[model samples]
Structure formats: C-alpha cells, structure tokens
Target: MVTPELNGGDVGVGVGGGSFDFQRYLSARADAVNDALDRAMPRGFPERLCESMRYSVLAGGKRVRPVLALAACELVGGDAAAATPVACAVEMIHTMSLIHDDMPCMDDDALRRGRPSNHVAFGEFTALLAGDALHALAFEHVARGCGDHGVPADRTLRAVAELGSASGTGGVAAGQVADKESEGLPVSLAMLEYIHVHKTARLLEAAAVSGAIVGGGADAEVERVRRYARCVGLLFQVVDDVLDMTSTSEQLGKTAGKDVEADKATYPKLLGVDKAREYAADLLAMAEAELDGFDAERAAPLRHLARFIAYRQH
Candidate 1:
C-alpha cells in the first residue's frame, strides 16, 4: 500500500511549468485508447452488443484517466508507447463502471456523455452484458498488450493485481455499495469520504499506479503517483458534486441534480456549492505538491487537470 506521508507532500499550486499541451495530450491519448480498444476487441460478437459497447465507450469524455496513466509513466522515465495498453485498460474499466452505474438498478441514469446511456440506447440486458464484457476485456487488453511490448511477466501481473484490488471490495465496489446505502439517509462527513475515496479515488489511484508499474517507475515514484491520484480523485468527486447542482443536463451530458433528487449524500449537499469548490481547490493543491520533486514540466497536465476538474461546469 502507498503510505500517507508519500501521499501528503507539499500542496501543488499555480499552473504547471511543463510544456505539455493539455488538449494535445488528452486528444492523442484518447485516440490511442480508441485504437487499442479496436485492436483488442473481438472481431465478431453479438453485433448488437458490440455496437452498444462501442456506442458508449466511444462517446466523448476528457479521457483524463488514461492521460494520467500515461503521464505518470513518462514522468518515471518509462516509454509512453509501452504504457498505451494499460492506459486503454484504464479507460475500458472506467467505461465498464459507467455502464453499470447507469443501470436502472443502479443510478438509473438516462444519458451519458451528451447522449442516451447504454441501457437507454441498448436494452438493460445488453448494457449489462456489455459492462461484463468490457470488464473482462480490460484485463485481456492489458495482459496481451503488455506481453506484446515485452513487459516483464511479473510487472504485468502486478498491474492486473492492482487493477482488481482497486475495483473490488476494498475499492470501487465498496464505494458503490456505500453510495447506494447512503441515499435518503443522513450521512456523516466521514461516510461521505469513505464513499468517494473508495468509489472514485481507488480507480484513479489504480490508473496512476498501473502506468508507473508497467512503465517501470521506481517504487518511490510509484508511491508519489498514488498520492497524486488520491488528491485528484477526491477533487474529481467534489467537482462532480458542484457540477450536478450548477450544470444543466445538456451541458453535463448526464442526468444532472440526480444526487439531490435521490437524496444522495454529496459534498455540495453537505458543504454548499462554494465550499465544495473550495475543497476541490485544496485537493488540487495537495496533488500538485505530491508531484513537486519532478520537473514542473512533467506534471503540467496533471496540475491543469486538477484545475479543470475543480471549475468544470460539466
């Protein structure tokens, strides 16, 4: 496990000094993730199910998770190209979570990324199957792509282990369960933290650590990346809360105000919109501090990314 001290270094402030173009990095990495998905997916499946998965997975988002993975790899002196597979894997897993989260049995979201959600577009059964398929495909893609790149078997295995651990009971799944239970119930701040940390932060941490592991980061740097991910992960949730109350469904491309409607516990609900925004900023600063030892240039995308998360309307 990554230590808390490593996670809590100097807080990052100001725009990153790195030359990395956030737009270019996001676009290029998203394209690579798409290409990897195309290459890794089966050529023939139930065509309809395939289409359903494609529809949602290919939907536009910032692809922030994959970008983080790639950046962490590069900062560790690892080849970005070699990390592409894992980056794609992170996206696949993220997509899978979205599919499941949108289920009627889950969040019951009707839209995603500015379009009808997978369950709404495709049937609930198909959406469920697609989510399952994507979950399996994530591991398959990572293992095959990493093997093709000659990543050591042990490291590749470690990446898989990390992904599973973060997405399972100790991580994302637990958060989901907590989220479901917390609705309509008065939840304490600690409970809210538990949900966000496990549900959102775990996978974000996994994405960063997976990239570092596959890219061959030293243990120390891997720990630092994990810390960075945690700060950003919590910030991501806080901004999400702020956006839900402030952004339109059209702007967010998802069901907005669902948290309030469902009486789900959210930072904004607890702290109000302005305070939630302030909290997000604080988390971003901490994340930046975690990356201070690296050249400012190397961590620019991450710094801007945190800011983007804090202020994003959608």
Candidate 2:
C-alpha cells in the first residue's frame, strides 16, 4: 500500500501558482466518466427502462462525486484510470439517488439538471425501476470493473462495502428520511447537520475512500481523504441552500425556492444567508487543511473544487 511520505513531494497549490487548468481538467475527467457511463449502461429488453436510467445518468451535473474519486486516486499516487470503476460506480449511485429523490414520494422535484426529472420524463413506475436498476448496476459495475481492470479482490470488496453503506440506511436513505420527517418542523442546528452529514456527506466520503482503496492507498490516506470529502459534501449542501434563495430557475436549473415552498430547514432559513456563507467558508478552510500534508500540486484539484463549490453561482 502507498504511504503518506511516498504520496508525493513538497508542492504548491496547483490553482494560483502551478497553473492547473481546472476547467480543462474537469472536462477531460467528466468526458471520460460520461463515456464510460454510456458504455456501461445496459441497452436490453426494456427499452424505456434503459432510456430512463440514461436520462438522469447523462443529465449533466458537475460530476463532482466521480471526479473526486478519480482525484483522490491520483492524490495517493495511484493510476487515475485504475479507479475509473469506483468513480463510475459512485456516479451511478449519485444518479440513482437523484432519480429517486425527484419522484413524487420523495422530494417531488420536477426539474433536474435543467431538464424534466426522470419521473416527469418517464412514468413514475419506470422511473422508480430505473433507479433501482441503477443502484444494482453501481455495485455490479465495481465488481466487474475490478475484474476487468485487474484490481485485487480484497480492494474491490472494500470499495463495494463503502458504496453499500453510503447508499443504504447509514447514509443517503437515513438522511432522506430524517429530512422528510423534519420538514415544516423546527430543526435544531445539530439536527440539520445530522441530516446533511448522513444524507450528503457520507456518499462523498465513500466516493473518495472507495477510490483510494481501489487505487491501493494506505488506510490512513483513505481516512484522511474521507474527512476532506465529508467537509466538501456538507459545503455542497450549504451552498445549495444559499443558492435556492438567491438564484432563480434560469440560474439553478431546478425549481428555485423549493426548500422554502416545502418549509424545509435550510442553512439560510435557520442561520441566515450571511451566517450560512460564513459556515461554508469555515467548512472550505477545514477541507483544505485536510490536504495540507499531501503534495500541494496533487491536492490542488480538491482545493479548487472546494472553492468552486463555495463560490459557484449555479
């Protein structure tokens, strides 16, 4: 396994000093991931099911989760390509969550990625089944991807476990349920955090950790990356809450003020926009601190990513 000292040498943050082209880097990685997703998606007996799954999977968000997986792999000195399976798997799980979350029973969102939600584009039942299929496909992709790419069985198993927990009760499901229960109810700061951490942070943690594992990172390296991703995950949601109030549908690509309409407890709702912004800044700083030990160049992508999430208009 790779160790910390061996991860990389002293380096500068790639953003301001080293001239890392973040947009180019993101585009390249996202293109690779999108292509892989297309290739991996099943096109079989149920044509509509396949279409529905593809609809959301290809809907085009930031692809932050999968990109984080790939970046974490490289940060630990592993081949970025070697972690593609885990990266793709994480995206699939994320996509499935988006699909299910947009259904009538859950968040009941109609717009996603600036387009009609899966349930809106397709029938509700088909959208539900497509989500279930994507969830199952995510695991299968990892197992098969490992075999196809020559990753060790132990590493593959560990990645699988990380993903399972991230998508299961301990992660997204738990968070979603708590969020639903807390809707229109007074939510404590601690309770709001619990909701986001489980619902949002855990999957991001799993993504980075799984990528590190598949890329053969030492345990310590994996855990450190997990911490960093957890901060980013919470930052993502906080930014979302702020944006919901500030941006419009034209900018956000989804129903703006949806949180307000739902009477949900959001950072801006409880903490006020300024305080929420301050909290996001604090989270960004903490996230960057977690990368201090790594080669600065290697950690630049993640650093910029934190900033990107914090300052993004959309």
Candidate 3:
C-alpha cells in the first residue's frame, strides 16, 4: 500500500491512485538489492562459497531489511542508489544469521522462507562456512560501499561504527544467545524483551540510522529515524509472532507452528494472539507518529513501510 501524504503534490501513481503500483516499488527495491549484491561480492572469494552465498542471498524473499534502509535514506533526501551497498550488506548479515540459526545446533528447522534450509541444501560444514563468509563479507561490503560513496570520511566512520554495534556481540549476537536459552522454558517478559530488542530491533535500528548517516541527515533527523526504526523493529517481531500462530506454511514459506514445536517464547505465547496483533498495530502507529515532522512526501514510503510490516502475513 502507498502512503499518501496529509497534503502535497504526489506526481506519481500511489497506493490507490492512477498507475502507482506498490509492486513497482517492491520491484525497484528488489532490483536494487540484487544489483548491490553483485557489486558487493569479493573478487577472489571461493567459487563454491560464493555460489552458496548467492544461493541464499538471492533466494528471492521480500528484501525487507534493504528496503527499510533505502526507504529511510529516501525519507532523508539521500540517493537510494548511494545506500544500496549498506542495504545489501545488512541483508547479507541478516541472511547469514538465518543460515546459522537454522542449523541443527540452532533453530534446527528444515525449511526457510519456503525452501530447504541452507544447512539442509548444503552440508552443515558448507553451510557453516557460507554463513561465516557472509558475515565477514557484510562488514567488507559496508566498508567498501561507504568508501565508494564519497561521503566525508568522518561520516563514513560513524556509519561503520553504527553497523558494527548493531550486528556484533552486543546486538544480534546477544539476542541469539538469549533465544537459544529460552527454548522450552516459560520465559519472563524481560528475557523476551532482551531477545526481541537486541536480536530483532538492533539491526533495524542500524538500518535506519545508517540510511540517515549516508544521507547526511542532521543529528536530530538521525535520532528521529532511529526512534521510528525502534518501534517498527519490535512491531515486526510482534507481527512475526502473530503470523507464526495464524499463517499457513504456504503463506509463511517456512514451517508454521514451529514456535510451539520448539517451545520458543513468542508474543502470541506470552500475550495471546489477539493482544499481540493489537500491540503490533500500536507500535506501527507509534512509528508513523515519530515521522510527523518529516517532509511528508519524503516520508511516505517509510510510513507505508511501517504499516506493511504489521500487516504482512509473510
């Protein structure tokens, strides 16, 4: 769905307008992600490892993280093209996490986004290497992408720092550890908060913040976008928990009901499906509200993106 501004000249097709297809935006974003992926690959990386990275990285999911980054960059008047490398890097990191998370030692699922898990398709050792390779490559892409941008050296350094903290031990890694320990146990809300905030929200916050930095958003704007991102990040997970309870495997492209199977604590389990859905809606609303002072035209995509996160069945 396209988010119409409260008031403005919307020169193009938007959600309900003449020819503005939301799918067009999705297509453009997907193409951008793929192009960035091609640019970010290492020249001499092993052909086999490159093939596996490509296998998952190009596996054709929604490209949500990259979209979020691009949307944030656009909202701040940055060239979406300039943000492509960082977008692709963040997505690579995300995909790598998924690969490792699905290993027998981790979430142990046989399916992902609707196909055999990476570990299932490649041997566990190869999958392990692929995941590790992608992780290192993510940082490499960030450094290279930032360097190519001609951004001020200081700004580039800040961007790299933000990305590092978000994906490193204090962020996604910490969340992963918490998730591993929570299985089959009745998790406290505090622990669940740790998992969602660090594991899920951290990367999202990084995406938005990086977008602003690359776009040269003023300090205030960067902070605002980060706040918006935090709300949406948690909202994303809430919707995920809700979908896990209600969506079918065909819709989700992965094993549904596996949360129950694994006894993983989720919002639906902790707060009930109805309440979780409501919470997701509220968080999205908060995210939109945070953008109230932004240039409405520029922020339209981000607003729509926030709503899309909550409503997306997949």
Candidate 4:
C-alpha cells in the first residue's frame, strides 16, 4: 500500500476520500474525555493526595489513548457512551504510569506535561500514593461505570482484565524493567523492539482491543483492531524517537535529546533517521491496511489517526 505523504496538507482528508475533519474530531472527543476524567476523581479528604491525583490527571496533553479507545468502540458499532468508562480508565492508567515514571527512582525527570513532575511538586511519597490511588481507581471506575452505562457484565469483566494486563507485570512494568536494565548496555534491535512493544504498544493495543470488546465487536473484528493498534503503537514510539532527535527543548516541552543523553536505545540510534522514517511509513501502511476490513466511513478516524501520528510535528 502507498501511504500518503505529509506535505503540509490535511492528511485527515485522505482517509475515505475527505469526509472527516480529524482536528475537529480530536478536539471534541478530548473535551468530552477531560470532562469525564474531572468527574471521575474529586477533591476530597486527604487534600494532598487528591490534589496530586487531580494535578496529573488534569494536566493537559494529547488524549491519544482515550481517543483511540473511543474511536475503536465507534468503529465496531458500539455507542460512544458505552465506551466512556474504558476510555477514562485507559487515561487513568496512563497518568499513573507517567507519575511513577517521573519519580526520583525512575527517570528522575523534573518536568512533565511542561510542568513540575509529580514528585517534585507533591513530594516523592505523596506522588507514589497518588499513582497507586489512580491505578486502583481505574479498575473501580471501569467496574462501576460500565454497569452504570448499561454495558454487559461479561464485557466489563473482559475490559477490566485487559486494563490489568496492560498496567501490570506483563506489560508496562516488564518494559520498564527491561529498559532500565538495558541502559548503558549495548542494545540489539530485538531488545529495543521488546522494550518499545511492551512499554508503549501493549497498553495501546489493550486500549483499542478493549474498546472493541466492550463495543460488542465479534472476535475476528477485535483481532483486527488489535493488529491495527499494534502497528500504530510502534509507529507512535518511532515518531517519538524521531522527534527526540530532531526537535529542540523549546519545541518538545520536555527536554529533547534525553534518549541520546542517557545512552538509551531508540530507533534512530539503531536504524538511522532516514531508515527510521522509512520504518514508520511502513508501519503506517500496515495500520491502514488493517482498517480496510472495516466500513470506510466508520474507520476514517482511525485511518486518519495513523497519518496524524506519522506527520505530527510535536
């Protein structure tokens, strides 16, 4: 498949022959997801913990994971309302990971979302608990919200399991461990791929696949969405690596060149910038091909999403 080039034109129009406005779609869905997230956790007792939780959760960034979940749900003919809980749950898990990942024991980064890292603002212990609280609350929200939204119990159970696996030892945690161990060590392409696939792609895959499962997608349909998400997930990391190499600190919000600075493994380090770009193009083509099995109009958002990730400047 010939993937569309990023020529400063609106690539969203390339999906399904120009019927969708991806910017508009992203803004609207992001607003809805933000509102739901705000309501999901409130200022309550233990003021500091709640405040820390709210701080990270409300911090603005691209709501990419949640958007993917909702879009996948819609593509499977599920009501967006029914998928709201899963969407919020994915964001909560993501936020929790960010909080922990930024702590003194981990990346030790002082900035997140262009603001103070959670541990820096709230102290290390409080940040730790806040992450734990959000992680627990994610499961709780899915359990209660799905039922409240009238999604079937079996589907809710499956969603809960998916979230668990993505957040736990089998997924993000595994990737993080491997990443830490690999630092300063000569990393082969396979090891780097393992780290990226587990740390980044697994949660994304779960997000998209869980949405399909919750939205009543057939087994085969769910598998296809999983494939699409896997391709997009790897593409996301590759783009991030490229941006790290090319963008400046002012442009990236966080410190750019951190990967090279830390001697960490990245696609650009292994494959060269041009080859990394070629790999990203290939991944985007594969992702788009997976969407071809679905209805074109319903699949437009996801199709455009692949291109957006590929071409986004920051």
Candidate 5:
C-alpha cells in the first residue's frame, strides 16, 4: 500500500504561525481514506447486497473519523499504513450507523449526503441487511488488514475490542436507543449529554484511542488522546446543533432545524444557541489542551481538527 504524506509543508503556512495546514491535511487524508475504502469493499456474488453496502459506504462525507484515526497514529510516530485498516473500519461502522439511523424505525429521513438515504435507494430489508453486513465487515477488515500489515496481534485485538465496544450498547446503539426514546419528550441537559456522548462521542473516542493503541502509544499517551477525542466528539455535536439552528437547509445538505421540528433534545435547545456556541468553544479549548504535551508539529493536525469541528458550518 502506498503511504500517505503526513507533512504539512505541501499546503504552505498553517494558521497561527504556520505550524500546520489543516485543510490540506484533511483533504489529503480524506482522499487516502476514500481510496482505501474503495479497495476494501468489492462487488461480490450477491451483487445487490454488495452494491447496497457499497452505495452507502462510498457515499460522500467529511471522512472525519478515519482521518482522526490516521492522524492519531501519525501523532504517535506510527506509519499511516498501519492505521489504514482501523480507519476504514471506523468509516464502515459509521456508514452502518447512518444506514440504520435513517431507517423507518429510526429517524426515517430520506436524504443523506445530498442524496437518497440507503433505505430509499435500496429496499428497507436490503438496507438493513447492508448495514449488518458492513458492521460485521468492519471487524473482519480490521482483523485481516492489521494482521496482513504486520501490526502486533495484541494491538490488533485491542483495536477490535475498542471498535466492538463503540458499536454496541456501550456506544452508538445505546445513544440511538436513548435518542429514540427521548424524542418529543421533556429531556434535561444531562440526558442530552448522555445521548450525544454515547451516540456521537464514543465512536470518535474509539477511533482516536484505537489509532494510538495500534500506533504503539504508551498508556499515558493513549489516555491523553482519548480525552482529546472525547472533547472533540462532544464539540462536534455541539457545533452540529448550532449549525442546525443557524445554517440553511441548502448549506447543510440535509434538513436544517429538524431537531426542533422533531422535538428532539439538542445542545441549542437545552443551553440556548449562544450558550451552546460557548460550550463548543470550551470543548475545543479542552481538546487542544490535551495535545500540549505532544510534539507541537505532530499535534497540529489534531488541534486544527478540534477547531474545525468547533467552527464548521456543516
């Protein structure tokens, strides 16, 4: 596999004294991730099922989770190639979640990434099966890819465990269940935090921490990465809530203000939009602080990533 360039030099001066070019970093890693994903899943005997899985998995998005994995690996002096499997695994899990999240039993949305949702494009049963397939494939790919790439078996096992935990009741599933149960009901800020922390933050935390583990980070270093990821994960949702309230449907590429429409609990609803924005800023600060002990240059990508999540409009 071709190694991705992790250097910031190609993008010229970065923000705040030319340390890193976040946009370039994001673009490069995203391209690499897309390529890896395309190569990872191929058409199989059950053409329709494979196609359905590929359709949603290949659908465009920011590729943030995979990039986080790669960046975390790079930060710990690991080769980007070593983290590719985990990166792809995270995207697969994310795609699976999206497929399920848009199903009739869930959010029941028809649009995703500016296109028809998985269930709309494919039949509901097929879409559901597709998600299940991808979920299983994520772990399979991680195990096989890590072993093939010569990552230590122990590290690979740890990564697998992290991904599994993040996908199951302790993570996305738990959050989704709570979110569905809480819809159109009076929900407190604590409950809202619980839902987002589990639904959104846990997987991201897994991505970052798994990368560090696979990258051979020390225990203390892994903990720091986890804290940073947790903050950024929350920051991601807070910013999403703010954008849902402030941005246009066109700019967002999906329904805007739908949280309010659905009577769902969001940071903006609980804290007020201004306060939600303030909370996002706080999360960003806390996330960046976690990186202060690392090499400044190596930590630049993560720092900018936190800012990106905090300030992104969509």
Candidate 6:
C-alpha cells in the first residue's frame, strides 16, 4: 500500500501529488535487483554447496538493502545501473546474515520469506557453509565489480571496507549478540536502540553510504545519506515489531509474533503500539529531512520509501 504522505493528505513533509506509483517503482527495482543477483551467482561445482547458497539468495525478500544502495547512488547523480554490482554485493551479505540468523543456534525460525528457513531445508552444516560462502562472495563481488566498472580504486576500497564493517562487529554481529543476550531479560529503550542500530541500522547505513561513495557523492552528501538511512533502518525494525503485534503470518509471509513468543524485547512490548507508531512517525520525518536539498523528482523515491516503511500495512 502507498504510505500516508505519498497517498494524499500527507500530514507532513509534503509530496502531495499522490502520483508516484511507488508499488510500480518497487516492482521494477526489485525485478532488476533479482535479475542482477541471479547473474552474480552461478551454480558451480560442489553441487550441494552451490545449491544451498542459491536457496537462500534466490528466496524472495523485499530487496530493501539493494534498493537503498542503488537509490543512494542515483540520489548522488551516479548512474544507478552502474551500481548494480555493489547492489548485488549488499544483498549477498544480507542473505548471509539471514542464513546465520535463522539457524538452530540463532532465532531458530522455521519460516522465512514464506518458505522453510535455510537450515531446515538445507541442513545446518550446509546452511552454515552457505552463509560463509555468501559472506566471502560479497566482498569478492564488490572488489571485482568495482574494478570492472571503472570506479576509482580508492572509492572501491572504501566500499569494500564499509561492507566488511557492516557485517562485522559494530554492525550486524554486534547487534545479534546483544539481541541474544537480551532474550528473556528486561530490556531498556536505550539497550533496544543499541541492538537495532547495530544489528539492522548498521548494514543499512553501510548500504547507503557505500552507494553514495561509489556513486561519486561528495563526503558531505554521503554522510547525509548515512543519517537518512539510520532513521530508515530503525524505522524498518520498529515497523516490523508493529507488524508482529498486529499482522498475521499470512500477511507477513513468515511466522508472526515470533518476538513476543520468544520473550524477546520489541518496541510494542516496551512502548506500546501507539507510542511505537509515534516513534516511527518521528523517524519518517527525520529521514525525509535529510533529502531536503536534493531535486524533488530525484528525491521522491526515497521520500516515498520512508513513508512506505511508516504506513505499510502488509
């Protein structure tokens, strides 16, 4: 569904036309991202291993990270198509994290994106290996694609480092550790932010920052995009928590209410749904603020994206 602002009567951060066709935009971008991902990975020798990797990577997702990367690139006036390899790299890393996150040792979720979790379908050992392989491939693909596309070596190197940092501690790994520790324990709002910022926000921030860098944005522009992504990243998790509280498995395409069932802390569990929605609204405003100076037409997608995160019913 279209977000509140993009739909019409946009309470704040006015983009009042209600004509962006966001769903169409998302479908087109997702299709291109999926196709690029398909070409980026080929079935190779060690048949089962390749199969495991393909299983998770090909499994459908919202493609948020890759889209963020490409959009940030375009926002900086870079040819979004040239950013394809970096986009694919970000998605590969995200798939890697999901593989590990759903294992028996982690969230142990049986359903992901409407199918059996990777470990359930592929076996833990293979799933584990697949995660490792994808992680490695993310860096390799970034490096290879950067060289082929004639991106400046320095920029390419920075993007590579950025992805590594996002996947490592201080990013996804650190967030996962905090989340696991907080399970079944009382969690403060600050601690929750720490967890989500590190786990979810970090990778998303990296996605936009790296995209901006490779897209040839100035340092100031890249930093601004980072701030915008930080809000969107947290907004994503906040919305997820709300969805778990209100939506069904049929709507979400995955197991619903997993957070509460696990006794894990969530925004709704702490702040209640109304307050959580308020927080999401604040975040949406902040994200939109960061795009203020860019051309409205070029910036419309990012604006629509933030609203989508805020108002998405499904």
- Best by the lDDT measure: 4
Measured over all alpha carbons after superposition, the RMSD of each candidate to the real structure, in angstroms, is 5.2, 5.8, 4.2, 1.8, 5.1, 2.7
Task: After the best TM-score superposition of candidate 1, give how far the Cα of residue 127 lies from its true spot, in angstroms.
Answer: 1.1
Q: What C-alpha lDDT values do all the predictions have?
A: 0.81, 0.86, 0.81, 0.89, 0.88, 0.85
Off by over 4 Å in 5: 1-17
Candidate 5 residue 114 C-alpha distance from true site, Å: 0.3
- Measured by TM-score, the strongest candidate is 4
TM-score for each prediction?
0.92, 0.94, 0.91, 0.97, 0.94, 0.94
Candidate 5 C-alpha lDDT tens digits along 125-152: 9999999999999999998998777789
Kindly give the stretch of ten consecutive residues in candidate 6 with the minimal lDDT sum. Answer: 1-10
How many angstroms is residue 187 displaced in model 3 relative to the true structure, after the best TM-score fit? 1.2
- Measured on C-alpha atoms, candidate 6 has an lDDT of 0.85
Q: Give candidate 5's whole-model lDDT.
A: 0.88
| Better structure of 3 and 5 per lDDT | 5
Question: For model 3, how big is the CA root-mean-square deviation?
Answer: 4.2
* Alpha carbon deviation, residue 242, candidate 5 (Å): 1.2
TM-score of 2: 0.94
Clashes of each: 5, 0, 2, 0, 0, 0
Model 1 root mean square deviation, Cα atoms: 5.2
